[model samples]
Target: MSDLPILIAGGGIGGLATAIGLAQKGVASLVLEKASRLGEIGAGIQLGPNAFHAFDTLGVGDAARAMAVYIDSLRLMDALSGEEITRIPLDEGFRTRFGNPYAVVHRGDLHGVFLKACEAHPLVSLRTASEVLDYDQDGETVTATLASGERLRGRGLIGADGLWSNIRKRVVGDGAPRVSGHTTYRSVIPVEDMPEDLRWNAATLWAGPKCHIVHYPLSGWKLFNLVVTYHNDAPEPVAGMPVTHDEVRQGFEHVSPVARQVIERGQDWKLWVLCDRDPVMDWTDGRVALLGDAAHPMLQYFAQGACMAMEDAVCLSAELAGAGDDLEPALRRYAARRRLRTARVQLQSREIGQHIYHPAGAHAALRNAIMQAKSPEDWYDAVDWLYGSTGLEGAVSREARTLGPE
Candidate 1:
């Protein structure tokens, strides 16, 4: 094996997960985080069964499970009528069918799972406030130039730098990310503050015209993560901007009082104007490749962004392990395998937002009717391509099956 550690730009979940996957395959890695401290932001994220597959494969299954709040179902409500639309059970049948449980976790807790594993691995080294500005690679090695103008060389470089990735600017060169005209507000509040009548052990979504509300228990029922989004034609892209409760309430007035009450209870609300990009085929350039949002940023409607990124980590490690010292082709293969799967997610997320979550009148009726018709088995088959398998077939799946610390 090469003595040079793989240089990973960004110390977020994707980057750290990559370090763990690579370490399990007897590879060494150095994670570069632009942040002064390594941690995750945001309230909560939903994890599909596929995420569990990746977690188990990355050798953090038990640890990840320990931090997750396994919900009873994926419940949907009609915000217009305050009526139950449908629910896909996450009971024993769901777990048996998917080979893992559907769950939710605080983003920080999930990131901590990987951070702890990466910190403990002998093959993984972490750095903070060291951002990779760009890179230049020759036939044998890739050298990353940090923001401090220091150059570090490695056998390869992986960009998991997220939505505003410097590595992606050099690799894909697609320019700025597309700003979807939707605004989202997030808040985490104590469970007691959540309405007792509405509190349930489920990842619930209240869908109305041009808006939606999602909430679920987190941190062992100590907190509730509230995310409300409105399609109010927000012009520019914005992130983590603090907004008043009145601002968050602008477009949700039309929803049922039951659903509107969820938004009213939220505190310390932060706003994020949703953004995504049209999928591009190539994300690999020689020994430099992209992962996570850096590679394929998508809307949050599908709730698969992080899950897809972790899957990228699993596949990347497997491909690199299979290639031995030949790094370039391995990286290319990794991008190829991940492109279609992630792209499907990327495009579908936009569709889900437009047609499912934010539709009006007849459209809402159609969505409710179709979704209501789905049985547990029907829902299972609908997501078969995504959650039925880890979507990392052949080499990746084979590698995942051999997971263990080096």
Candidate 2:
């Protein structure tokens, strides 16, 4: 590898994970974050066994596992009936089969694990408030322009700037992202404040018509993360907007009484309008490439958005590890390896949002019936391609078999 570090835009989970992955391979990278400090702002995220595998590969598995809440199963309940349609066992047998445990964790806790590792690694350089503005690359190197008008040169650039990436418009020439027409309200509260009967430890989803709610214990069961999503035409996409509890209650007024009770318990809710781009074949241009949400943004239904981004970090680092003088070829190889798999995830996430999360009338009934008919093992088999991982190479093969041709 050259002495010059690879320049990474956006210091979110994907960017930090990329730095960690490269440092593990004896490579150097400079991560530029727009924020003044490195921190994650979100409720909760579920990590499958594949995410654990990626974390282990990056040598931070122990720290991540220590902060996570291992759940026994994933239960999908009908909002109207308050009955579990079916549950996927993520118990000892499942862990033994997948080689890792399923965990639900606060997003900040997970980001903190990667951020600490990146800060400690000798090969990683992290800079905050140095937002990437644009880039120009020659045959030898890429120069990234920062918001402060400072120019930094590096061997290559990785655009992990996230959903509304500035680099994507310049690289792939893709226009604005497509809005999902779904608005999300999320809140986290102390577990002690929650009702005794509602203090469930497992990852649970309450599915209803045109709306759904997901809640689970986080911070080692000290806090609970609650997210409620419904169909509403948000004219524009925004995040961290304050929403009144009454507003959220109105959205779920028609839902089951149990779901209503949960919604009523939450205070100080924050809102986000979901947006994602359609996957593209071109994520690389010369020595510049896109990673994570910049490369393939998807809906949150699959719970694989962050997981896939972390996987991309691992795959990209592996490709660039021993490529020596040729960095472009390594980038091309990374893009080729990820394009189809991410496209499948992107499409499947949309399908899940439309069919499983928010169906109406007859479609809703049929969705419930189909879910109730499947056995726990059958549900596991359906997502075998997602939670199973042997490494980057194994991931490509499994994704190929599961998603078929591009």
On lDDT, the candidate that comes out on top is 1
Estimated TM-score for each candidate: 0.96, 0.97
lDDT of 1: 0.91
| Backbone clashes under 3 angstroms, per model | 0, 0
Error of 1 at 367 (Å): 1.1
TM-score of 2: 0.97
Off by over 4 Å in 1: 394-406
What is the C-alpha local distance difference test score of each model? 0.91, 0.87
Candidate 2 CA-lDDT value: 0.87
| Per-residue C-alpha lDDT of model 2 across residues 1-406, encoded as one tens digit per residue | 3889999999999999999999998989999999999998888999999999999988999999999999878888888778777777888888887789999999999999999999899999999999998999887799999999999999999999998887787899889888888899999989986767778778888888878999899998999999999888777888889989888875687777876788878879999999989889879989999999999999899999889989999899999998765899999989988888889889999899888888878897898898888876777778777788533853456557777521
